[model samples]
Target chain A: MKKKWLIGVLLMVLVMSVSGCKKDDQVVLNVYNWGDYIDESIFDTFEEETGIKVNYETYATNEEMYTKIKNGGSNYDIAIPSDYMIEKMIKEDMLEPLNMDSIPNFANIDDQFKDLAFDPQNKYSIPYFWGTVGIIYNTDLIEEEIDSWDALWNPKYAGMFTMVDSQRDSIMVALKKLGYSMNTKSVAELEEAKALLIEQKPLVLAYVGDNVKDMLISGEAAMAVVWSGEASTVIQEYDNFKYALPKEGSNKWFDNIVIPKGSEHVAEAHQFIDFLCRGDIGFLNADYVGYATCNTETMELLDPALMGTTYAYPDKALLENFEVFLDPGDFISEYDRVWTEIKAN
Target chain B: MLKKLSSGPYWLWSFIFIVVPIMLIIAFSFSVPGEAFKFSLDNYKRFMEPVYLKVLARSVKIAVEATLICLAVGYPMAMILARMHLKYRTIAVMLLVVPMWMNFLLRTYAWMTILNKNGILNHILSFFGLPQMTFLYSEGAVLLGMVYNFLPFMVLPIYTVLTKMDNSLIEAAEDLGANRRTVFRKVTFPLSLPGVLSGVSMVFMPAVSTFVISDLLYGGQYMLVGNLIQQQFLVVNDWHFGSAISMLLMVMILITMSIMNRLGQDGVEQGGGNIW
Candidate 1:
């Protein structure tokens, strides 16, 4: 009996070793992206069209995606990170320069998104989705014209409003209200922003993340500071809701897809990127996610109702005032310190 | 030799998964960010600031409150379960274990739905002509989350100890003409002290180190030591300071467990009996 049991165990070990060394007849592309950012059916369509299996994973934030890739434990062929993080990764020599020739669909992207600060010359990244941070307020509860950041601080709306809990976004709101750059390195300016946040804490119903959309939809709060894409979705569901871009302006952000330095399947990654840039695919994703697509071809295909929406296509006058958050470089620690103080207090 | 060989897999597993990770954490705790690993004390020094200290103090305060609340609620329930007949006790224990089978995140999400301003709790209150209660993002909400999640940890250990307790001691106290209250205080409570200590440690350890409960229930406004460490590592990418905070939290928990162990030993001696 003992000999038979030992033979069974040895057979199992041999089988496992054999399976581990099986020959790869098909290409596999590992893609990591933000959670709920893509339409799920796109994966199946891509796999079927290209005959390449996709190993898809998701992260909640750009920083989280960076840490996983930087640690070198997991290798993903493609990652979607925001502009500031993409800048940080490029500086750290953690991204590979894209071979633009392989991505002919790159021509479909709007020229306005090209040659941006994070990856000037489009050397290492392609813009995925671009949106602005704004306020979503209930028309029923809010009687005034909500066009400025000052509405968030009004004591009349005390305990009736929510703000995004992200460190950069939350701090950016205060900085814009104070007539300071969101990326200001001046300690005095940052201290002023920090104090404004501390004062606003009592009036904030909660400092939430994506739950701002939920809070607004459920009528739990009179107003919520939210992203343009999420705000558009909430507006569709609730007729009483309206999204406004404060006249002082807000952070205009872009998320882009790029290949990390050590990714093994560069060719397949390029194929995946080019496929996503197709006008139909881009339109499908943009419409499904309620976000603005960077592909100019996709823009023409978008529904007229969506094109007319202010959140997705803000006025040119309003657009002129938006600022993208720059890479803070060594000053990031200072911002983190201020954020920690705000939360701890 | 055969027995030693039989335990070889366990030793290797612990060495690889447990010992190696801890060694790396200690190495990271003393290293500087954005530099090659080397011995430095900057990470620990950074934590000495009053801002970080206040976070630590608040974490300890809230954890202590949750642990005490657990003991107050759990001890009586455990005692009642222990004293019940076999069939009824089994049904009661089953009811307690049912919630544990669900994922903890799902359970926390349920609380979120119930406590929000337009949630079921407030909806019911307003239906009865009462005012709405906004309790979603408060310290009380955080405490509620901790207690709801960790109460089972407090109950199971005490219940096991009480079930295994010797009945002869109680009979002896009764035969000596002692009343029910005297018997409970003199015999049962003293003998159960070890269980109480273990339960407190179990509850306190997780309560003090949790980030998700507070982040979700309190709307990410409040910062605990756990949240501080998480933000350092994940958000700010400052693993050095995160590692140092982790080490400090580990040492703090170790000291607390040692004190509880000493008390348990004293309880054993005073009761003139040994707990399994």
Candidate 2:
């Protein structure tokens, strides 16, 4: 009786395994992006319109996405990584150059965003969203206007503010406050930044990430160093919270979509990129994600209230203070060591 | 022949899942990043730096503290559970295990909400006119998280050992004019040492290697060895150094386990024979 039962189970397993392998003629395009980055409704719309199945995934950081793609087992066709990471991937030859003819919507991108440092010829990546890093503070907590990064180190506000947990962002705050370039490669400059951070460590309530938003909303902190996108969402929801672009300047960043080398569905990946670039689609994503859109048509479609706000869309003069993050290449280890030392201390 | 054939799948599973991955990690630990098949000890040398060693020492310190706390609290609870009425024993054990069925990360996240500055604990404290304290983002909070999560591992093994203990032995000591305390000191505790050893290893192993607990509870300020390794591999893209740290952690754990095993054997010898 046991033998017969075992045979029956084995046959059932064989049948189930075979059925699992069965696939329809539809092509599946695996699109990996930041967690909570896009409108979920767009997936259904894209699938319905194109008949290309969307296998969507999310990663929390650019490094995580880069590691997974570089490791080479995952079959992800498209990934959205930041400017520095895109540059690193291109230098490593891990990205496939885009065929611009396949994506006519490339013309929709603003000329200012195009031919930038990361991909000068716009070969490997397409601009998705761009924003700056700044401080989001509650007006009721601090009486004075916060126009400088030095406000972070004020002993009066000790234990009332948080810094970004990221290595580059936190180091940039220290460097900018000291009047050094945010992308300084000098060992002495980095050591000085490290010393500043270590000195400020006692005053910091915490070094936090995405949960900074929740902390601020609950009044756990008076201020936090945050990406402009996160600040925009919090500012729109809360009446008292305001974002400041410190006069000492800060990091401007862009997250762009790129196809990893050896993607099985390149054609479908280009199609998805084109679909994402449509004005209506870009508007939906930009509005949903609370990040500045790169598409000119999407800019025209944005809410007038948001456009009028300098923090969300800074004017030309204000833009000059922001510098795009450059890939440090081999010098990133110095950053790693400095950050480790600060955290260890 | 049939028995050997039946065990074939087990050996194959171990080879594919366990043995190969370990070999890969060992290989990576000894190699240089960005250079193919070039062997070097630079990764190990880098880990010998003071900053990384301090991280290692902190991880060990916290793990030891958490283990001791678990033992202090869990031992008496286990003894009580073992001595309880059979009817109550089931309910008590169920209560201990029910919370563990929920996700580990979820339980840690729940602590964040309770310990936040404006969270439930502070609210209660303020309601009673007590000053609000910062409970989250401290070494204490991280230690509390570790003890809370791993307490069950400490309790269950000791409970099993206590319950399975020979009642006749205790009765004989009583009949021979030995008091309860004398009997427990001379007999019961020695026999339960094996369970204690296993429990210590179980709790200490995970506590030492945990990154998430420190990351969430201490707000990235507290750097543990686990977090150091995670940062190297994920953020720094330096797998060689990460692998070296992981290998060192593995060696430390192995040494600890072997020491515990030796102690357990000595306990068994003192108790007159192996009880398990």
User: TM-score, chain A, per candidate?
Assistant: 0.95, 0.95
Q: Per the 3 Å backbone cut-off, how many clashing residue pairs does candidate 1 have?
A: 0
DockQ of each: 0.87, 0.85
The parts of candidate 2 lying over 4 Å away from their true place are A1-23, B270-276
Highest DockQ model number? 1
lDDT of each: 0.90, 0.91
lDDT of 2 by residue, B1-276 (tens): 769968998999999999999999999999987784998899899899999999999999999999999999999999999999999999999999999999999999999999999999999999999999999999999999999999999999898889989999899989999998999998888878877887888899999999999999999899999999899989999888899999999999998888777878966875432323
- Residue A264, candidate 2: Cα error in Å is 0.9
What is the C-alpha lDDT profile of model 2 across A1-345, one tens digit per residue?
A: 775899899999999988866655789999999999999899899999999989989999999998999898888899999998999999999998899999999889998888889998899999999999988999998889888888888999999999998899999999998989988999999999999999999999988888999999999999999998999999999889988888888999999999999899999999999999999999999989999999999999998888846557877676677888888988999999999999999
User: What TM-score does model 2 achieve against the real structure?
Assistant: 0.96
Q: What does chain B score (TM) in every candidate?
A: 0.96, 0.96
Which parts of model 1 have CA positions greater than 4 angstroms off?
A: A1-21, B270-276
Distance (Å) between predicted and true CA of B140, model 1? 1.2
B1-276: candidate 1 lDDT, tens digit per residue: 779977998999999999999998899999997674678999999999999999999999999999999999999999999889998999999989999999998899899999998899998999999998888899999999999999988898889889988899999999999999999899888888878888898899999999999989998889999999999898888888899999999999989888777878876775422323
